[model samples]
Target: MTGWRIRDYHADDVDGILRLWEQMLAVNADPVYGLSDVLASCAKDHAVVAVVGDEVVGAAIGRAAHAQGWVVFLATAAHVNGTSIGSSMLAALESRMAAVGISKLSALMPAAAQARVGAFLQQGFALKQDLHYFERHIPVQREELKILAELGGRVLPRGLWDGVGGMNAEKDLLERRVVMPLAQSELADRFGVVPPRAIVLFGPPGTGKTTFAKAIASRLEWSFVEVFPSRLASHPGGLAGALRESFTRISELEHAVVFIDEVEEIASHRQGEPPSPTQGVTNELLKIIPAFREQPGRLLVCATNFIRALDAAFLRHGRFDYVIPIGLPDEQARWAIWERYIPDAAVDIDVRLLVEMTEGFSPADIEYAARKASQSALENAVSSGAEDPEGPFIEDYVAAISATRATVSAEVAKEFREDIETVGRL
Candidate 1:
């Protein structure tokens, strides 16, 4: 006869439950329910323990709903191997939960827990085949919502990452360098890859630097907070003190992606005479970055139209992991951008021609041209009093493209390529 006898779990048996949980992990029999859940069941739900005198060596925890009972946890101490203690505990746990009028008892365990399957079956449990488990964890918690609202941060919509049309090169680069490391941090760590804490996105104006920053935050499902230099300057502490306070509050969040667009305005090169008024702000930012890097699961993306104008020390090795270039869109990217702005109902618009014509246009320029074309078409159709006013025609778009001035001039584009070679770090 077995020396161990099954009984209802008591507060004194808590130490024994913890010991068994450790052994279960050692054997790769991963529990579906976490330790906290098992502990709660022992206190408020159904639990049974197998004890030899006052020392417990086995435990089974279960919880019941309207008609279903689930084995939350089950395990026998390593010292009591090749015995029926596990099966006995399961039987006792099931009996205790039966008061809830459960029609059936079930269990969810990792595939690694097969070593204990025999014990479960011995207790009249049947195994199911061809089953799988899927889980998704939301990044933010309810309690964090208040902190986020106060910080003027938000959780961007799910599709923003995918919705960012065109700029394939920039997208692919950020995905590998920033998103992959942060999203798959554990996997990255296995290969000795330190997840990036900060990065710089530099290019000419209207090249979609800010869009990429928001997309990175969206892809990671982290809070996105854009720090406006102009807005911070109006704070009572001035730009420097306000910047410090902003980051201090940001530390309260579990994970965040902080963006500072036009960072050059605050981090510009310190120059000449009695020093620029912005130099102190730049010095404060330099001090803030190291502290920011110490925290995991945070990324600071700073974008600048003029990389040359940024202070040298601001983009140093330890401060930012990568300084990537987001340049003008290519033909394929232009085609994709054009497709985004085109109306679904618009017929025979000859988009390929429009794409060909807007060779030097930016995303902002494309959006402007697309909207202008629709407005002009609507005005013409109204003025002529047509029976059915169709969507904007190719001729309307062509005129719009001709009228719209590209944001990046040839001189600016040339300087951007030069900055890419000299200033780009990726």
Candidate 2:
């Protein structure tokens, strides 16, 4: 058995801690705060370390100010894995903070650090739900950004920006319906039941499936992993490798959200047709699902445009636990969608008329209309050489509204609604 001891940070242990921090950053690529900064912060008596036979096995450094505490660094030596030393060190730190009348604590961690973050949460840290750290490096020259853009990678825009729109409702639903229930249910203690059940969100394209996935991940404080189906099938038996990697990475994440957009291409069930040699992909994925279920803090979400085309096997219990039908927005949801996209421009616009006209419109359709309107207004202003122009005029919105027809025709919507009703009755 490995022995463990917790002690104050010491000058002698600086080198070992530095090595541990370097190893952590190497594996995670998190920006370094430098050894001098860490030492200066530790001098305030907020640093603690776990030593296993003269080697620093685990450590946590934090600072307290104005009754709030922040955890700046936490790491465990890679060689001393699975000792629960990291968890113990966190507990000790929490206890120490409590002694000083500090109860609230926060930390910034990479998405890959889910397991370690989970250890902290288990020790009674209340996660701040919203707020994610998204960073992209800036090249030395603007030309580099242009080159990156040409290669189809996005260059970070100057300054930090939150994604457009709000997630309050989504956050509330995730916390109340998913996170809190899972936390209090029997799943809380049973690793086999703790991992989020595989769920399928199927609906019209651009209906916010991807956004909903990210919001859920954020609300639950789960690391989100987005997988591209095209890359999953690049090799012979490559699908298996890809699926395994996704599950393995999520397992390591310890409360991760694995979202597969356009999932029908991968997990779709095949029946009555000749077996595909690539059938190994489905088999491999099926096997991994159970393994993920056995691990705590893993969530697998699949979104698709066609639900009926999917294999019945995938819909069976223990595979995809829920098949959520994300249909086109209802009248109320359409109004909300319009309000979200055209916040300022909607001041004088008849939102009720817009919603009524867009009876069959999906969330994506509404957003598209708003954006098209905005673009049209910008172009008109530039062409006219106006002294001043407002963003997205009502007339422009009306013009954009007239340009496109509803994606979900009335006949199609009726058929879908009836089919769902029939299924629910069954």
- On TM-score, the leading prediction is 1
Q: Show model 1 residue runs off by greater than 4 Å.
A: 1-134
Lowest-sum lDDT 10-residue window in model 1: 130-139
What's model 2's TM-score? Answer: 0.59
Residue clash pairs of candidate 1: none
Per-candidate TM-score against the hidden true structure: 0.70, 0.59
Give RMSD (Å) of candidate 2 vs. truth: 15.7
Model 2, range 1-426, lDDT digits (tens) per residue? 367788878878888777877887787746345667677777776888988788887788877765566677778877764336666676566546644645366666666665576556544455554432211111112332333233222222211112424334443544554556455557555644443466777666666778777766654544457777687667455777867865654454435567888877876776545768456666776787777667655667788776666666666777765566556776767776788778564437777777777777777778788889888877887988879755666777788888867787777676556645532111
Clashing pairs in 2: 255-297, 269-311
In model 2, where do residues sit more than 4 Å from their true spots? 1-176, 183-196, 272-274, 343-347, 422-426
Worst 10 residues of 2 by lDDT: 132-141
Write the residue-wise lDDT of candidate 1 on 112-202 in tens digits.
8765677776655667775322212335655566778888898775557898997888899899989999999999999999999999999
Give candidate 2's error at residue 194 in angstroms.
Answer: 7.0
After superposition on all C-alphas, the RMSD of every candidate to the true structure, in Å, is 16.7, 15.7
